[model samples]
Target: MKINPAHLGFDIDGVVADTGGAFIRIACEEYGISSLTLEDITSFDVVDCLDMDQGIIEAIFGRLLDDPLDAGLQPMQDAVSVLHSLAAKAPLTFVTARPHEEPIARWLEHFLQPDTFKSIRLIAMGVHDRKTSYIKNLGLKYFVDDRLQTCRKLAEAGITPLVYNQPWNKNGHDLPTVNNWQDIQALCAE
Candidate 1:
């Protein structure tokens, strides 16, 4: 399909970087809970998976303010290659549910070099509800995300959402799906 870069939107957590593992580990340590496997945490809401109230989750995240750069997060397979290719041809924006920018920026800086990070137009952060609206307002023609509910809502809102495959969202029966960045690149190229 040869989508123009201006039309694409990307989710950060599962799409660009693998934040799940770190998030789960931090959740466990901060909340004094046992480590959760992907299977155990997938069905639960983001906050519930951490076994903490929203307030505590926010506080734990805040503590990370000092040193948010967790070298533990690795880019999903083929993510950098695909992003590089796409960015070379078009604008790519990273839309995330992360509320803060500094930590996100620090994390990205640690993982992705300056040239790659600069290719991104903006890293939208904050609550999930606002993300859909942000994509709409920006006139994004397509979006890639790992959350089933988010993908469903994006599709319902009239945007083409390529649901990035995740074990947590595996039971879904909606939206177009991609297993990794390689698949996503092919989908966008089509």
Candidate 2:
């Protein structure tokens, strides 16, 4: 696909990879805290809801971010196929809040099929409002993300933010939300 960066944008984490699942896996397998449910992760700061110590949170994130193991992060069930289609038709850009570069790019590469989305862009803007800033600066007409806060920011800035449904940030927002990649494909095409 001859991708362009002017129109559509995406956020990684919950939207693309099941990072939340990976986090829960760590909390259960490594951190010795099992029995956590998706419903319990009421906030983006899921560790806070887990009643975990700061050190444990840091360790979990540290492993996930800086020194993640070889365990492959699972892509959204429909993500690979949907993204291939979208990237072929519309300009697709990925802007994530992850601070590092290699891990995320590598993760993306893992699922990127051969001869697809040659011009696809993966941009990292780290923390805070950087995601919003990047989206605005790029003048993206549409964006998909799981963070309601980020989606609200994009909506306020006159960008269409398509909320990808997750356990956290699923309620209290009347914004356009999609349940799966098929919905994302439909929404973006709309």
User: Could you tell me every candidate's TM-score relative to the true structure?
Assistant: 0.78, 0.88
lDDT of 2 by residue, 13-72 (tens): 888887778877888888777977667778887655667787987777777776443544
RMSD for each of the candidates: 3.2, 3.3
All models: lDDT?
Answer: 0.73, 0.77
Best by the lDDT measure? 2
Off by over 4 Å in 2: 1-6, 67-69
For candidate 1, the lDDT comes to: 0.73
Model 1 steric clash total: 1
- Lowest lDDT 10-mer window, candidate 2? 1-10
